[model samples]
Target: MKQWWIIICMILSPCLKADNLFIEAESFDKKGGWVLDNQSMGQMGSPYLLAHGMGVPVENASTLLQVREAGEYRVWVRTRDWVKQWDKPGSPGRFEVLLNGKALRTTFGTEKAVWHWQDGGTVLLKVGENSLELHDLTGFEGRCDAVFLTSSLDLLPPDGGNELADFRRKMSGLPAEPEEAGEYDLVVVGGGMAGCCAALSAARLGCKVALIQNRPVLGGNNSSEVRVGLSGLIASQPYPNLGNLLDEFGVVGHWNDWEAKQDPSSARSKQIREILQRHPEKKIHNAGPATNYEDEKKQSLLQGQENLSLFLNMQVYDLRKEGDRITFVIGKSIISGKEYIFRGRLFADCTGDGEVGFLAGADYRVGRESKDETGEPRAPLKADRLVMGTSVQWYAEDAPDRSGFPDCPWAIRFTEETCVPATRGDWDWEAGLDRDQITEIEYIRDHALRAVYGNWAFLKNQSSKKEQFAGKKLAWVAYIGGKRESRRLLGDIVLREQDLLENISYEDATFTTTWGVDLHYPKPIAGMDEEPFLSYCDVQEIKPYAVPYRCLYSRNVGNLFMAGRNISVTHVALGTVRVMRTGGMMGEVVGMAASLCKKFDTYPRGIYEMYLPALQTLMRQGVGKPGFPDADKLD
Candidate 1:
């Protein structure tokens, strides 16, 4: 693995002085309807604006630019043909770069599959402020990273390399040194359930904490952007209050068909209605709607905290380390290219991909473990990179009028034989099972998009039951891929599936996990061979078992603590512990341990070695208010 110091200098670098005129699409004053997507910034080189209009073209995004050299400058847009990788037919991501109310001659996003500078010929710029617009032709998913304008046509921006990275620093006029974002007692990365709980717990315990989230919202998969419902049982057995923090902020657990609940003719509708009758809070469901996730509630909780500070749209690319301990971390705002340097005492790797641990050179494992290695029955014979897939969940709803959907020849083609005839695609609509979940995530997400649009196009146009779908239009499709498994940061004890199956107990056990060991595999469709778009799962049920405290903190990296799916566990054990609720409980335990670290003046391991009793007391008492069904009970 490349050291964090060497790899992330481009993104980590920030500046305020620039000789060249460069317009980052993310910095656009009026985004209109385009969304800022920093999820694939590492691979694509920078965060970009995504026009996710479902099937309808979105309103144009515009920004005013001040040009010092007002003249005919060669225009270049950083974009790509999103579906060109598979040699697909049409360009779904095609868009135009406009200058001062006039569209450019060349159409962008119709060229290379990889991120490249598409020449828009030359455009005239005013002496003062000029109106720049990104006109989206098709809202399928048009992306624009940055727009460059130089007097010299020969001076083309390098596609992607160390040179291009350095050029970005030069063009952005960012200074070499980073601005300080203040020191903290605890720093929690990744604003998912685990990170949120970790920050909340630590903050409530009177530790000045910093919670950094790449996206604008808090919850990762469970956020409105992704819309995955929280799963697994919370508040189980000893230290029942471990998950109590979740209750303070509403984290919905139930996963019922949202549409079916509203349908009087549907069988499950009655059951759903009855559930809601008893508890109106049961309105939440997987991929239900944007309102179902209640992102604002989570945001309010984080903002209301006295000791906790929230840093949204700040993606941490690199960290500074003193020996084994991380001294500070460098994160840049996705919107403004300014750097944020957070110095902290103890750091938590709640980033589900184990990003902090990976950057810190902590011992970690990716993919499945061999059966011989873990002695687990479910472990594969040979170790392989077959981790669980990423889900781009989608759903369609009845439109006010008969809706029209364009043919998606550029997307994955589907026929009656291969198509999944359903209005809503759930967790099973997964892709990139065989690909690297980290490096190749853009492809993974795009593959899922191709499958979704292709299937939707078929269902809307060519399916035998096309009349049944004529009234329905695509409502919401998650752009942010909800990941299941990734890099597992290794710790003092690597929990195995056999431990839960055999009901093994640990003296230092902290949080309890009750989710089944559910692992996903490709569904094996008839026609799809290039990339499987659907998946099936093999669920191995496990009793509520407490995870050892040793699994929470890193074995090699001294001050780091981990939660979420990235915790120290074999592929088999990740099945049970990967669920959001289980991960949240882990966060609660981690937070309690973090407070202990500050109090005893010790690291994460030292808390276990010297002050395990203190952590236990904190867990038993808990941080959240009781009687709200205990930490919003994930199950």
Candidate 2:
């Protein structure tokens, strides 16, 4: 009799009354054409589901919700009007909510620039499973963070920022303290080519490593999400064997157009054809195939190492510091609401934003430094907010039949005078150099999107070449913004342009940088009313210079190390070292330094001061696989 009573109670428990229910949009089982976007979490407070319709309305996003009571519940949704910044009359990101196959009276995603609650009148929910759906009304970009249903008439949705963050944690029933992920000798934040090499190099040397990336994929810029072809020469001059690991892990074949045309006269073309013949599964086309991003290949390589652990979709938000050292970092999954605490003796800040260094209170700089500050002639006479712009590359496909694109009124308008008569958006298509790349990332990305959509609309509908583009359809546009520069974490030595021009050698030199000082600016094109999306670049070649080990670690933070574009360099010097391949070599050197830290039981500064000779010996011997022909060589 007691067992029967307990079973009955267990079945009846869900039917009991409750005050409220919270549903995170990202946690929905069936996303259906919606993208999980966590890029604005720092500013908006939580990851949201984005219906990034490029002028065509996407399918509805539905989720199953269990109600505790069958009664009238007030509905509230968190969203924003993305185009509100333009002070536009109509909201581009408008959507509707449906409950149990019935459309609600209120329309969502019409709020202003800030994230807020949009009231959806009373709804009748049953005391069982109910279908909750998000219907995009416009073919722009509609976003939904979370939905809240409450019985109390006075209860309102949580406001944005820290309050919203705390409310999310409470609503999600996440633990108050972060769960211990694991202990490691080294923890690397950022999963770009640099971070991957750093973690792999350290792990191969028998150090336990934890590589945490905010995105679902491993590579950052090089990943399929961004699709930037690797540039700059690796395994050259000063350190011949330093970048051998890069060839082992990097994507094979250059993005040269000749390779796609199969021109036997070009050496690269013949080599690519031979490679494809050997491995038919690998495709080599223009800018290489989408597979060249190699998401699985990177994951497989990291998983093969027993000492290394890869954590994807984990965004590090906070860190615990003991004096000058970082003890552990706090990360939260973009998919799930679970929080993680990763403890390590050493930490590498490969995040291009320099997030770890910023959190640890390490000194850093943003934008361009004046000529007086670094004595670089190319720098501005007076310091101002001007840095290399971010890129949003895109491509189009030829359709057998003519295709039409909708007119995007909300996007930046382009006239025939300003129409770019091209089907591909390469490195030149860039913007947002004057804005804050870290805090204003969403705005920058949105601006790029507007540029692409607006320009394509003009070409297809209004431009003189409309007939030419009629048969072409928009194929792919990178949603992940390819950032060129951000916060430069200060180190013991800040590399300057003079170092590369004079070919100065340091005792702690590890890798060689062959790329010239390449900087970007928004140059005016004839007949354009406003600034063009395409950027103008200026390059000055210098002798192959060795990068110092002193520029790899933080000066103030004892256990902190950094690589990639965030390394210590002047705005002028960063022009050369910011290339992906050069950054990958920097990562290898940092990885070696991390292994040395473990062996000597010391910090980054200690490795430079006390054990300089040992590091030189390791650099001389090299850590990467030998005998693999150097794929990228300088003239």
Candidate 3:
């Protein structure tokens, strides 16, 4: 984190309005130990710096501030005490803003449960250049959004809404309009398995494509940050070649080279056998090590595409629609605060959250539908805001030496009765089921963090079997929450449980969904009172079924396409198709459709209405080779 090279040149412009100097924490030159967390950028305004040291306080995050006036500047730091909602004991996310090595009079992230500006009294500074450091007090999840230094005594920052947005824009000196990011035939607004495949598939079919991901990496849930292995059987019939590109994508050369080899003596078969035999520890679902996901390989795979332009660390927040069809989408960099515009003929919302579709005024649904409406056996009696929870997966490994963890009275405590009786967390360790998955994501993630730390603290400090956990230390606890269900974008047909159970096939059947109808709910724990941290998965066994192409394209939005968990589906149907592998197949189909649209100058609906045969031909024979354009094409 040697940040001296990142010179803080703010307050240098003469056209600036006020003497107030505002700096987004993510813009720091050298972040040192702190990580950029923009998951809650929609809820909160800007991305902030998070001190995710687990229990141990990380190294200092230093930055050089160019102070113009250098007088008595009243400092205000935007932050929140994440665990304060439960009204727990300790302030785990406490930190201080240091100016010129002198700690501020006020410690931030100690009070407000919601995001607010915490006044750090006054600090005297020298004119030219000054040192700014975010001093972390607890290794827990401390956060700082932006550091505000103003000569004004009475003016305070807006909590949120349009006022705060305009205030930050004018003060931070960001452009009023977003920077243009070139036109494309297709713009996929996510970097998940579905989005990657959609972008790759379209690009391979000779369409100019743009793949935009909010995070620093390409893969969303399967990235090393989230550490979820690919699920659902790939390369299934009616179109066995729908996932050929995905088959060639794996961490090591072993699985990446696999192509339905049956010969035991062949090198490819032997290599596949060896790698799977070696990496038995990596689970197929969640809570695996970082190396298993292969973020680098996925990044390289997308970047290697000839017609695909991949942009990481970019989040699409808004869109421009002429009538019902989307013309352009706007995204901003999560780290540098730079905004870019993506003008495209067709748009795809693979953002598990349906961000692009939502921006386009497309119809979408959240939570379960009433059984009366959907006629599904497992549907809730009433349509409510009870969606599936998100998982904050974690794991522990044997430490080199025995060490004791700190007491976490502020965290969710576990008695001997409520102790999970486990050293690691998996898909079951979920949170934020009842809350809004889109708006209150930060709250959802923070609650899971407390559960993880709290459960571990009990096992290590208070449980009768504490001796067993004495040698174990938390290796990884994913801060990037692996979400299960959220917004389900509505299409011409909303695939329901009956469709999968009855094996009803559509004329435009596309990808095969093999996973069972898996739905998750809050598990009832014995002693815990609040929303349960554990999840109870109620799964209904079902044979392989093909999903119609109607579910892939939007019903009203003319040019919009969708893939991933966000595709048109009932809450019940989402269980089977939401998995990464199945979503990848959806991307493959969407990408192929995007290519046909580019080739014919037709919309997403045109392919289903008139050009269905062409799409079927492309599906029968995929775009061929990972980055090879038109290797196996109908054009």
**Which candidate comes out best when scored by lDDT?**
1
Evaluate all candidate structures by whole-model CA lDDT and list the values in order: 0.85, 0.82, 0.83
Clash list (residue pairs), candidate 2: none
Q: lDDT score of model 3? A: 0.83
The segments of candidate 2 whose C-alpha lies over 4 angstroms from its true place after superposition are: 1-17, 250-289, 525-532, 627-635
Assess the local accuracy of residue 72 in candidate 1 as a C-alpha lDDT between 0 and 100.
81
How well is each residue in 1-635 modelled by candidate 1, as lDDT tens digits? 23223323323223321224678899999999899888787777789999999878999999987765667888889998988888978888889988999999998899998889898998777777788999999998999999987766656677677767766666676776789999999999999999999999999998999999999998898888888888766657887767767766673433344433334674434644555665554565567778667688889988989999999999999998999999988998999888889999999999999999999999999999999888999998999999998999988988999999999998888888988889888899888889899899888999999889998999899999899999999999989999999899999999998899999999998888887899999877886665798899999887789999999999999999998999999998898899888898889888889998998899999988889889888888988776453222343
lDDT of 2 by residue, 540-623 (tens): 998778899999999999999999999999888999999887888888888889999999999999998999888877777777
Candidate 1: give its CA RMSD in angstroms.
Answer: 5.2
- Relative to the true structure, candidate 3 has a C-alpha RMSD (angstroms) of 5.4
* TM match of model 2 to true structure: 0.92
lDDT of 3 by residue, 73-105 (tens): 889999998888888887899998899999988
Candidate 3: give the clashing pairs.
1-32, 89-410, 90-410
* Candidate 2 or 1, higher TM-score: 1
Q: Name the regions of candidate 3 deviating beyond 4 angstroms.
A: 1-18, 252-271, 281-285, 624-635
lDDT of 2 at 588: 88
